[model samples]
Each structure stands twice: as C-alpha cells, then as structure tokens.
Target: EGIFELEYLDLEIGRCRILEPVKVKMVVAKTKEGFTVGGFVKTALEHPCTRCLKPVRLEINGVVEALYLPKNLASFKREKRLETLKNVIYYTGNIVDLSERIIEAIVVEIPQKVLCKPDCKGLCPYCGIDLNEHPDHVCDKISQESDIDPRFSVLMNLKKNEEEG
Candidate 1:
C-alpha cells in the first residue's frame, strides 16, 4: 500500500477546479493473467452552484480499479485480449501509467447537479437577485401571476385537484 499524490490534473468539469492534490491509497496484486490494482481517491473541487451561481466546494471521493497486462498479450489469439476483458490496459516494459484510469474514476463520482446547499433558494428568474440573500424578496409582477403557459393549465388543474382530494 502507498499514498500517491496526483498534481495539477485537468478534469474538464464545468467551471470546476481541483482544490488540492488528490490523495490515493492503492494495493497491487499479481494475477496469473496480469496485475490487479485497486484503490480509493479523495479530493475536493470548487464550482458554481447550478441554481444560485454561488461558489460551491464539494468533497469528492472515488474508487480506482484496473487490470494491466503485457503489450504482447494483445496479439494472443488474433487480438483476443482487447475484446474479452473490459478496461484492460496493455503496457510495454515495467512502467504502468495510472493517470487516465484515475481520472475516469473521479469523473464517475462527480454529482450531476452541483448545489451550494440543499436549501439554496437560487436566483430570481425575473430580476436575477439571489433569492438566498433575500428570502422574502418578491417581485410585484411575478408574485401575483402564474408563469406557466396556458396550454399546461389543464395539467396544473389536475395537480391542484389531486392535492385537494
């Protein structure tokens, strides 16, 4: 087991930046076919909230698992190694690069919807004022009106009747 420091890697997440070096702990096992590496990674990233546009810092934790085989294995049985096992990396010589697989592991752990807080009120659609800062701020024209299109009023009435009943 060892701690690996991942530095200055670009993840291409929208408006997001890695806050620090990724902390990773890994263990390697030798298999008859190849090598198996498994580990966990932890880090934090900062991005704008999807709703409020406030800077949101989120802690990200992910797992890393990969299989590595010698480059010569790819030619076995007419390139059969490439088709059989999923996510197998063939490496030449003694060096194995884990950077790409590490990035993939982190990408899957990222939340689809990033929010500053669970109860973030977000920005007002009419005036663009941050609703979290002023929960009671109501637009004169917006409060008394339903912004839903008239074509969807039938669906709205159905919801209202369902709630009342």
Candidate 2:
C-alpha cells in the first residue's frame, strides 16, 4: 500500500482536495541481460480556479520504469542505465515519502488562470467591478465624451472644414 501526507500551505490555492490514494504499480522481470521494474502511477487531486476561485478536479497518470543495476564497482557507470537513473526517484534504505511528489504533480497541473466558464466576464478594467453579477451596471456604457484634449479642438474644426470642402 502506498501512503502519503501533505501539510497545508497558507497561500490561497482557493480550494482543493485529494480524492484517491496514490497507486504505484511495479513489476520486476529477469532476462539474460538484467532485471527491470516497470509500471504505472495513478494519482488524483483537486485545484481551484484562479479567476472566480472555484474548485477544479484533476487526475494524473504516468509510467515508471527503472533498471536494477548492481551497486558494484564493475557496473558503476553503465551508459544504458542512465535514462532509468534520470527518471527514477531514488531513496536511501528507508520508506519513500510520496507527499512531495503528489504536491508537485498537482502544482504542475494547475492552470495559470482558471476561469469558471469559457466565456467568463472578467472584472471591468475602468471601475474594478465584476461584470458577471452586475450586467445591468450603467457605468460600463456611460461613454466619456469629455475625454477629448482641449488642445485638439482647433484640429477638429479644421478637419470638419476639410470634410465640408
């Protein structure tokens, strides 16, 4: 059985949950050359939407394959085993902790900005208001006709005369 535990970080990930126990399946096979362990990893977790702060669920599935080379001077620098060594998570003769690994996977899966819906009406740039709830807000459509620069008024008159001609 695989066991993992995680402590909460104070940062607002919004809301999230870990749904299932992490499953690590391993198999050892012996051939004329050597033995290797290869299998799959299954993990499930939840994340929160960055925009409206809603929970989003996720599942991670991956494979793990490593060659068990003898820890001896003769086989110390096997080139073929380099790939396996790079991918494998090594542990000293002690219980391996999956907590950090699980957290890492979850963090990697989180979207930079998660919207509640595809067409989410985000906050108004001018007023810093959420347009979703107050669709009827009149401030959005109140066009500022006075934004024109006073120095440009003579240019506007000149343009109008040119159009008339």
Best model number under lDDT: 1
RMSD of each: 5.6, 7.1
What lDDT does the true structure give each of the candidates? Answer: 0.77, 0.56
Instruction: Single out the weakest 10-residue window by summed lDDT for candidate 1.
Output: 1-10
Best by TM-score: 1
Please report how far candidate 1 places residue 149 from its true position, in Å: 9.9
Q: How far is 121's C-alpha from truth in model 2 (Å)? A: 1.8
- Assess candidate 2 and give its lDDT: 0.56
- Error in Å for residue 152 of model 1: 11
User: What lDDT score is found at residue 63 in candidate 2?
Assistant: 59
TM-score of 2: 0.47
Number of residue pairs clashing in candidate 2, backbone atoms closer than 3 angstroms, sequence gap of 3 or more or interchain: 0
Show where candidate 2 strays beyond 4 Å. Answer: 2-46, 57-80, 84-86, 136-165
